[model samples]
Target: MSFIRLATPLRSAVPRTAYRRLSTQTTPEKKSNNTALYFLGAGIAGISGYIYLTGSATAKVKATNTESPLDPKSFKDFKLKEIIPYNHNTARFVFELPNNEAALLPVASCLVVRSPEDLPEDDPRALKDSKGKPVIRPYTPVSQPDEPGVLTLLVKKYDNGVASKYIHELKVGDKLAFKGPLPKYLYKANEFEEVALIGGGSGITPLYQILTHALPDPANKTKFTLIFANLTEEDILLREEFDDLKKKYSDKFDVVYALDKPKEDWKGETGHLTGEVLKKYLAKPELGEKVKVFICGPPGQVNAIAGKKDGYQQGPLGGILKELGYKEDQVYKF
Candidate 1:
């Protein structure tokens, strides 16, 4: 029942639905129509017939002075090299950086993707207060950060998901504004004796990022146990990749699958992550911070992990973590 303050990124990384908007101030009316306004995700790049964006939602990048070419502050334009369809609702966006760009992707970072064009007027995801703004979303890359030459995102398409839908519709060769190496978590080798990775659906991306970084390093003996939840067999993403990693690092990694709608032959656990389920799978709190838990999923799952109304302000922890006697620092919500 102890309440501990969560980290800044963990508190702010709450999944924002497309319809939720940031607090916006009204722009002053200008008599001229051709005036250029600068905002995150507001720049455009004209391709052969289609146009993609080449701007950052975090800040405007100056080509003259940049800390590093790969830095998010130095937002760079990339071209979509390939699209691999994973299932009916998800596609992998493989974007390629210039040959000279930094290929090492920092562990557990993200990218801000902005569509060049705004959605139709009647679309629910279209900007409400900031009508002139384009749709954007933060996504974790599926490709290992150091995997040279390309950037890949395993995105799940939602009917009303603005960025996800737009990305799903993109063809190979289309370009988009990709600005980031937005580091969410700073991980060290064997920082924790044991860690639990809990994720659902598309939230599995970050968990995968951490998995790839930790399991393969022979120097890092951090043991990982992942509990991934999905609606059905079709919704389970990166199954092959996770399986491969588990086999490669047999002693260090293990994965558990949870399904909501199982077929007749389904043989694993099912339903949402209840306290009892967590008690059985999650590491006990005896070692304090030495044992850690990371969670990423839709709103409901995040709320359950971080606590209902318990973020930034350091409110009391709730849900399974609270029920399990885990401290706030011991659990991170992504």
Candidate 2:
């Protein structure tokens, strides 16, 4: 296999906000005093019943006119006004945002979409929040940052996946409320010399954005290698796009597909992506020194490759990569 290297650095059209660190200091005395003051204020307010009624009415009106405060970056609501299928189980949803603004959803950021009506009371995914309203799960965006007005999410169906099923059943003109640009795993362009993408099934969605953005930009110095593990040849998503990228940007991209089962004519790598296979495809440990690795898949594959007991912990890439002395900072799990 040939290794591809970038010819130029990739530049992001949108300016990135500066990273801020949070202060960790705390005081129990201040906490206790604030709690006491809050309760005392509440008790006084309760005695004036009309004050509470007026305040509630004002709050309701404000909520009705304003956007959801839950959005961290103060983004307006975007509606799913259209849907297009990429395959039998996956789809690309087109979201229509306010003012026909360019849909610039960053890679790894997800949108929390919900039906106009509340989910059925008995639905397992449906649960009452503190205010007794049902909450919905979040889904990541698969569309590019520059794609205008239409943000796409490539969703795969599962037998018990409530959100996926609901989204798939929708027609072109259906309206679904969504709020986001919620933060998730992200890698700033040109931050690392080399990047490795390890993905399985629908886990490829996030990596797709990363690869597309990284490869096309001349200002981005990052080089990428993808080790995509799937059940079969037919299970591989975005195969044509990857092939075209490999051919066009031969010096900046490399891809290896691992299938769980191989047919008679199968010629590419086969079987699960074990430690041995990782070692064969990954750059040497010396090269890994400047490389940032991203792994995403089913919990089992992610855990096995991530080599962590708890799902949240970050560590060296599992299997042979760990055995080869890769450090914790060199690998990331998604």
Candidate 3:
């Protein structure tokens, strides 16, 4: 049989569970005192009472916090509520929010996440990069912006990934500090006649966020096409959700998938995304600013499609998109 060596596993586009241990050391008097304090605080709040069972387990936000729990300026610690294994190296992490409120993030934004500050310096869970600076990563949330009580992230594990490994080992109720709905491209309904989202592996989250927010709105008249690439059939993330979108909004949405290796029965496009595939699938430059192409993936894929991002700058547009007659203004690199 002919064989194709696997490509380097896609670096998660900068993107787990365990059980928390309970202590049995509390004396009855301490417990009574804690319980009294909890109820006293709840009574003080009246209708908007605090209902968290474990004191100090959840992030502290203002008691009058409203609309969203995320603060762009400051880090807040949120407890892990659940973990669901999605594939061999991917999972969905659900984090608890204060008082059962929605994350309320704006469309096409992300959260900056890092290990809790309290971890000891030598602890394995404390993640640091090469310079020993605390490692922080941006993740696009998988749940809807208005999804209440929790925020969800779809994360793919990379072998040398410090953040992924730290997250995978966490037990339920463990905390991670998070900040921001750091804005990406501000997407608005009907602004574009057609939008093309090209993503690979874990990069799908941001594209998914844009679609979920836009497609269901009664005011939406925009059309969307997603060209998602992956290593194998099983590597396709959010397949079910995309399929449902195709069904419900048949006129407004469609998806094309490219796989590096394919099963005998596979029917989608084969091989990595290329100028040819993009030429076939992406909206034409002739459509002007009314058409937007968004690309997000591993560095290799993003660089190939739209050129490397220069630090925080979008950098100069080059590569397949530029070669195919798309302008820098017509594309957004995520």
Candidate 4:
């Protein structure tokens, strides 16, 4: 609701500076073996996480529902209500919902977006081909369903990405086709005595959803630890909010950062997500279902921790978890 609502697409979004390979075919969406989104970062004032939706105990009960927001096969049109630029590559896209219905979602779910091929084309993006067939991009909702009138997505822009490119090109008042709050994971109150979320980049969105949802539930006593990995200190997302969570709920929540590059002042772990970090931060696997591990992020991290993807199915739990004696059911990929 605090975002900028424009009547037309901003010319700034169009690439005025010439770049190579503008006409190359858009790549298909990769099937992630990565666990449903779960990651963390640190920040202080005005964190970008607020650009999505930061939760509180008071706003908790409003966004609960288990139905699909829209039919996946049949697209429902939603209007672009606002656009909030979070950083260089990420933006908070706000869309108006059709009505006052339940937000049609469960914990850790996503919807697909498609561009209309019927629009006047000044420059063709990857969303549709000449034949008008649309490519779908699945994105998890960052806004709580209780946030009235609008659904929010924290989008990370990509140069050759069909859906991201199409979404980036959209202006105010543009209608986008969306469908499904396809449930990825059904989380219950204190299903696990402890949950460890491992993620990086945008993968943290789903983890954020689960964290916010759990903290509000009086029945959920699940302690949480977040291990977020990124290239540099600046790359860490939602740092301040995570810090605030840890500060306020220090008894229940903990966060760890593993940056590939760190400054002199850096205090947390610095390296790839390896077994040592897992052993130090993650709850011991001996607890079984009382402790569950969730991972999401780069294919390398996912592949390393949970093995690769055979299409959408996880290949094997063959990395740090396996070395540490964690079983398949004990871990899940997003």
Best by TM-score: 3
Task: List ranges where model 3 is wrong by over 4 Å.
Answer: 1-65, 120-124
Taking all chains together, each candidate's TM-score versus the true structure is 0.73, 0.69, 0.79, 0.75
lDDT of 4 by residue, 260-315 (tens): 88998989899888887789988888998788988888778888887776666766
Off by over 4 Å in 2: 1-70, 73-77, 117-135, 308-320
- Candidate 4 least-lDDT 10 residues: 31-40
Question: Whose TM-score is higher: candidate 1's or candidate 2's?
Answer: 1
Model 3: lDDT of residue 29: 61
CA lDDT of 181 in candidate 4? 74
List the candidates ranked by lDDT, beginning with the highest.
3, 4, 1, 2
Backbone clashes for every candidate come to 1, 7, 1, 12
Q: Give one digit per residue, the lDDT tens place, for model 1 in 1-334.
A: 1112212333345455411422231432441122223211122221211322434334333233223345586545678999888898888888886653444657777877774333354555443234555655788888766555677889898876767767777788776676777877888889999999999989999999999888878798888999999999999999999989889988888888999999989998888878878778888988897998888888787787657544434455677787779987887776
RMSD of 2: 23.8
**Poorly placed runs, candidate 4 (over 4 Å):** 1-69, 100-102, 117-126, 129-133
Ranking by TM-score: 3, 4, 1, 2
49: Cα error in model 2, Å: 70
Query: 3 or 4: which has the higher TM-score?
Result: 3
Q: How far out, in Å, is residue 186 in model 3? A: 0.8
